[model samples]
Target: MTTLLPSLPPQSTLLTQASQVLMHNYSPAPLVLTHGNACTVWDAAGNAYLDFTAGIAVNTLGHAHPAIIEAINTQAQQLMHVSNLYATQPCIELATQLTQLGRFSKALFCNSGAEANEAAIKLARKWAKQHKHPHATQILVFGNAFHGRTLGALSLTPKEAYQVPFAPLMPSVKVGVFNQTENLDTLITNHTAMVMVEPIQGEGGVNVATPEFLQALRRRCDETKTVLWFDEIQCGMGRTGTLFAFEQVEGVLPDGVSLAKGLGGGFPIGAILVNEKLADTFQPGDHGTTFGGNPLACAVGLAVLNELTQPAFMATVRDCGSLLHEGLGQLQVDFPQLVVDVRGWGLMQGLALAEDQLAVGDLVTHARNAGLLLVGAGGNTVRLIPPLVVTPTEIHHALGLLRSILGGV
Candidate 1:
């Protein structure tokens, strides 16, 4: 264990002040985080914790990377905000770069994953009405898939726990079994407009879609002339040790892709990549956003893409990810009773507990107290999403902390 840091001022006053103003939608930890460096962040009380969550996979290059900070600073000085009515050079440049990488002809920018996905949904719906069967309005999504929080996205997310509060969402959403090839055939009827899936379901417990299953879905979508969409919001942008998570599964490509989370490396930015098939789906005034393609966000996104997609950087990620995986595998062997499975691709891995009685939340709480931070996913899974910039040494350190926690338990 590391040396205990000095205690700072109480955060009760801070929480009390925030409760008066901020909405009660989120249940944030009591600690007031002040600043972060690399994969470690210090709370207001001067205690540092190894950040495995990586802002839920938003900080691709880790917190406050010099490149991201410099890009934000430079763009802020030049031009910060501009309406979408006026074209910005930074946005155009970023779009061109993203198109080049994603094999898409066009791109649309947005502020968050939800907006990006919403754009995809709208584009798919438009295509269905105009191109496919007019009655084809059904959006097919998989069970345990989390697209986003918007009503359209929520309609596809079939989790009753999240959906009950906001009942009566978008119509004709067909929910199927994720990674189960047999179940998808029934769901993809003639009325199916779009089939949206995550290459790897991040919030749904790091469940990776089998390559065969994806290929089958691809074939079906092609046969039905339905738009295939991949929600790479959490699993894309080098999280899966590749440019896109779908790249890992060969012979399977989505007509549309929703990207966000790690795209801007901490800066809020999202985008949809559309292939030639759906490139012309959205005409002017079809769909838009006020702060979608702002210069500052695009500048940061460009910087993040440049750093993350480099040959050396990606090679390093592969090596570090291997190390982390090996360590986790060893941990699974060491504590088989506790760990049910360690499954995921690249840095987006998870440790699913053996039973509900284990309580993944309690493990996360204990890990946080031990100076290592983690987040829980569905299926009683503990997610380990350290920044892609994580080194081999850092990986070992994290494993040590995790082993210590497990040993104590």
Candidate 2:
């Protein structure tokens, strides 16, 4: 005989129950979000919040967009998953569009940013061994970089706190200073198989790479014949007022680009786009994923790409970004003691706090209490990454809330 299950408890008790059963990996806020629409989300207690985090920059078109919803519903009714053994129309079409948009010759799908970086790592190593010397296997990364938590990706992310527990990570990884073009020659050696850098370091306090720095890296990589890769997981896919962040930087392009986060607009999907030079790096059995290119995920990805590629949509992003930047600048001027600096491009902006006066977490809590959600990055910086569809009115309201919070503090 089968045992009957217990009834669900009230919404208020959900967090308590979660604490008992779930692992303590994430310390989420107290609010239990029920649903969302556009840039607004409502909790179980019926309180509405203007979401500036946008699910950590994963919700490209905002929550419950009609196109995303429709694509998911239609694709679910028809096809969802089929192993990579057979090809699917949505997968093929999405790949084709991505290749054309990213100006890459090939694409490899995966489940998350970590997986995409892992694939790029493997491809870089393999290509180096085949085309270059077999001993050229070093992977060069930068300081204050946050790639992902997976072993291979984690190895490249030079954080003492994240790496202390997981000792003995993947070997042959070197750390370099970000945006310091002076010492690039010393960092990237002939044995270096690949050099991975985030054009804009997200978790590292929105540290944007200078165009001169990127150009220097490209030149050095060419001199050493090393694969140049970019981790655009958080800053790519129209977040920076362009399809790719590299578009803003002239005379620089990566041999491979790893993408995820907003690619599927909330649906989980990751991909690596490689130029023709490294197009055939991965053989048939070299890399594969069970649910990477499933019909449902690819369908959602296509819908997101469709909306982001619209000329009007991208123009709106640029206009609103300028407005948001101006608002943040005003905040800095108003609260000179609290707000130290403001930085970032497009909709991905950050306000660096005066840590001596206010901590990032305290400011985040204040914003949440005032019905606005924000995310914190390194260097005491609070990120304001609202959806690409956020309006000027919502931005004004968010700024108003922030002004009130700072005034009250």
Top of the candidates by TM-score: 2
Stretches of candidate 1 exceeding 4 Å from the true structure = 1-9
lDDT, candidate 1, equals 0.89
lDDT of 1 by residue, 1-409 (tens): 2333446456666678878999999887767777788998987667898999999999999988999999988999999998898999999999999898988899999999999989998899899888889999999989789999998888888899889999988889988888888866678878889999998998999998899888989999998889999999999999888889888888887998999999989999999999998999899889999999999999999999999878788778777878888899999999988888998888989889877447888899988888888999999999999999988888898899889888878
The whole-model lDDT of each prediction reads 0.89, 0.92
Query: Among these predicted structures, which one has the highest lDDT?
Result: 2
How many clashing pairs does model 2 include? Answer: 0
- After superposition, the stretches of candidate 2 with alpha carbons farther than 4 Å from their true spots are 1-9
Candidate 2 CA-lDDT value: 0.92
RMSD, model 1, all Cα superposed?
2.2
Candidate 1 residue pairs that clash: none
- TM value for model 1: 0.97
Q: Write the per-residue lDDT of candidate 2 for residues 340-361, one digit (tens) a residue.
A: 9998889999999999988999
